[model samples]
Target chain A: MELLKQRINKDGDIKEGNIVKVDSFLNHQIDVELLNEIGKEFKSRFSLEKIDKILTIEASGIAIAVIVAQYFNVPVVFAKKTDSKNLDKDTYESKVYSYTKDKTYTIRVSKKYLNKGENILILDDFLAKGKAAEGLIDIINQSNSNLIGVGIVIEKGFQNGGKNLRDKGIKLESLAIVDSIENGKIIFR
Target chain B: MELLKQRINKDGDIKEGNIVKVDSFLNHQIDVELLNEIGKEFKSRFSLEKIDKILTIEASGIAIAVIVAQYFNVPVVFAKKTDSKNLDKDTYESKVYSYTKDKTYTIRVSKKYLNKGENILILDDFLAKGKAAEGLIDIINQSNSNLIGVGIVIEKGFQNGGKNLRDKGIKLESLAIVDSIENGKIIFR
Candidate 1:
């Protein structure tokens, strides 16, 4: 986590309105070695828990989840953000409000992917308003599956997403927690 | 390669449009052990070439490229399909046509990640129309980087992507090349 925070300080870009971009490693361009380390860390933390499947959202989270899934030795199901010709109509859907993008989009996973009494571990790149994570949790809840925990790479600590998940008694582990961005600088917790 | 073809035969879903969906273990739900095998296989094939970096596109390609990067002991730079807040303005962009959706989209790589004269190996999940592969090649061409080769997990041999790339004297290797699909049956070359 220290390494991630340091990398964020060195290469991360801070935009206005508290937008933090770690594209150099996290989003746009990826550091595979760092991702392997993160995977190991996640494996160490959640290895104890019985995780049936690893869940994440499409685009950003897929890379990290795929890396993490190696250690867990499980299959990864990424929730597609857009409707595709391939995805079945019978899907468990939920809406996520993206503060940065200023809109709500439906994230869906096929109903066949998640099942009853399965232990699910949700993973994602960023947890802001917790909408994305909550949406995944909502799908898992609908399936009558057990929501084991939520793992995130970066959490906007200033935002209520991480806090709300904690209040609801969901086990959340964010690798890097940003306390605030003071004067266009990052302050980590 | 035989294993991959066999896996495809076992789990891949053949749709009406010659679209084989290996979501169970390839794209939607990834198998890291299989990915590890793929990474090792890619390294074995491209071991002689001095690969400076591994390049791929977003979504499906990210997972394979990241895993393969470890074997090459290099970083991966995935092309962004959208110009998000995370990506910087300066980029090497290229247009890619998707056969699945029957649409074209622009993919961008940060000017920082890809450098001139760097040796890059393009990796992706499927090589159908080869638009994605060509798009990556275009970015590599623009950056003045040497495209060592292109790696693909599955190839629709009937589609002409691999043949086109090969015709241009480019090294394109597909793990499993499907000759045809008849009556929901896959015939591999």
Candidate 2:
């Protein structure tokens, strides 16, 4: 976690609208080494319980989830952001509001993937407003699966997502939580 | 790739339009153990070259690329299909025509990721018409990078994409090459 915060300080860029772009390592161009380390950390944190599968969203979250899943020794199911012709017709759908993109989109997972009473761990790169995580949780609930916990690489602590999930008694673990981003400086909690 | 062929035969569904859906293991709901085996196989096949980075497209390709990068011990960079506000303004873009979806879309890579003279190994889930692979090659060319080879998990040998790349003197390695699909039977080359 310390390594992650330090990496964020060294390589992350603070843009307008409170966006901390870690594209150099985390998202766009990935650092598989760091991801391996993060995967190990997540495994240590959540290794006690039985996790049947890891779920994440499309695009950014897919890379992180797949890497972390290696440690959990479970399959990963990524919720599709769009209704593609390739996707299954019978799916559990939920709407996610992306404050950054300023739009709400439907996220779906095939009914075949999630089974009743199966434990699912949700992982992602960033948690800003927790909208994406909430959407994944909604889909998991619809499948009658047991919500294990949520693992995040970087959480925007200034946002209420972490707080809301904690208030709901959800076991949430974020490697690096950014408490504030002021004048291009990222302060971690 | 015998394991892959067996898995495909067992789980892969053949649709109406000659579409071999391996989403059960290769994409969508991904099997991490199978993906690890795939990463090892890809490393064994492409181990002779010095691969600096692994590149792929977004969504489906990201999971495969990241897992494959673990064996190579290099970073993975996926081309973004959509221009998001989060993406860098300066990007190397190429248009890819998706015959399956019946649409053409632009894929972009941040200029900072792909350096000149770097040896990049392009990895992807499928190669039907090879439009996606061609677009990735175009981006690599624009960046002045050396494409070591294109490694495909499944190549439709009946399609011209594999021939086109081979004709261009590119080292294209496909794990499983499907020659034909007749009445739900997949004939491998």
Candidate 3:
């Protein structure tokens, strides 16, 4: 966790409205080695739970989830943001609000993936308003699966995302939680 | 490659609109072990190229690219479908038409990740229309990078994607190229 916060401070960029861009490593051009480290950290933190699968949203979360899946030794299921012709009809759907894009999109997972009573660990790159995580949780809950916990790489703590999930008694663990972003300054919690 | 085609014959669903859904293992719910085999197959196919980096588009492509990267022992740079606050402004953008969704979307990669003249191997889950591969090629061209070849898991040979790429003299290796889909039978070329 200290290593993550250090990496964030070293490479993260802060913008207006508490936005932190770690694209140089995390999302766009992935650092697989660093992700391995983050994966190990998540494994160490959530070792107590029995994680059957790792679920994440498409586009960005897939890489993080795949790396984390290596540690958990479980399959990775990514909820697609857009329905493609290739996607199956029998799917679990959930609506998500994107704070960055300022849009609400539906995330979908094949019903065949998440089975009943299976334990799932949700992982993603960023948690701003908790919409993405909430949507994933919604899909996992609909499948009657056990929610182990949520693991995030970078969290906007100033936003109510971390608080909202905690309010619901969810065990949310973030590697680096940003307390505030003021005038391009990043303060971590 | 045989394993992938075998997987398609076994688990791939032949739906209307000439669609084949491998969500059971390839796209939605990923089998990491199988993906590892796929990575090895890709490595064998593109054995001649000095692949410095693995480039792919997000969502489904991310999983295949990452699994393939392990075989290449290189970093994977996935193009971002939706530009979020986390995405860097200095990006390489390409427009791709999704025949599956009947829409066009932009894929962006941070400028920092892809350097000029870097040998790149584009990886994707499916090669239907080759629009996505062309878009990625366009981006890599714009970045002044070297595109060694494209590695696709499945190709809808009934469609013109494989032929189109071949006509352009682009080296494309698809694990399984389906020539026809009739009466729930998938004929391979």
- Could you report the DockQ of all the candidates, in the order they appear? 0.70, 0.79, 0.71
Could you give candidate 2's per-residue lDDT for residues B99-159 as a string of tens digits? 7567889999999999999999999999988999999999999999999999999999999
> Candidate 2, TM-score vs. the true structure?
0.98
Colliding pairs, model 1: none
lDDT (10s digit) by residue, model 3, range B31-77: 88888888889999988789999999888899889878977888899
Off by over 4 Å in 2: none
DockQ of candidate 1, scored on C-alphas against the true complex (2 decimals) = 0.70
Clashing pairs in 2: none
Query: Can you write out model 3's per-residue Cα lDDT over A1-189, one digit (the tens) per residue?
Result: 888888888888766666677877777777777888998999999999999999988877888888789888899899998877777788899888886787888888889899999999999988878889989999988999999899999888888999999999999999998898766777888
Candidate 3 chain A worst ten-residue window by lDDT: A12-21
TM-score to native of every candidate shown: 0.96, 0.98, 0.94
After superposing all C-alphas onto the true structure, candidate 3 shows an RMSD in angstroms of: 1.8
User: Tens digits of per-residue lDDT for model 2 on A34-136?
Assistant: 9999999999999798999999999889999999998988999999987777778899999998876778899999899999999999999989889999999
The regions of model 1 sitting more than 4 angstroms off are: A183-185
Q: Between the candidate structures 1 and 3, which one is better when assessed by TM-score?
A: 1
Top of the candidates by DockQ: 2
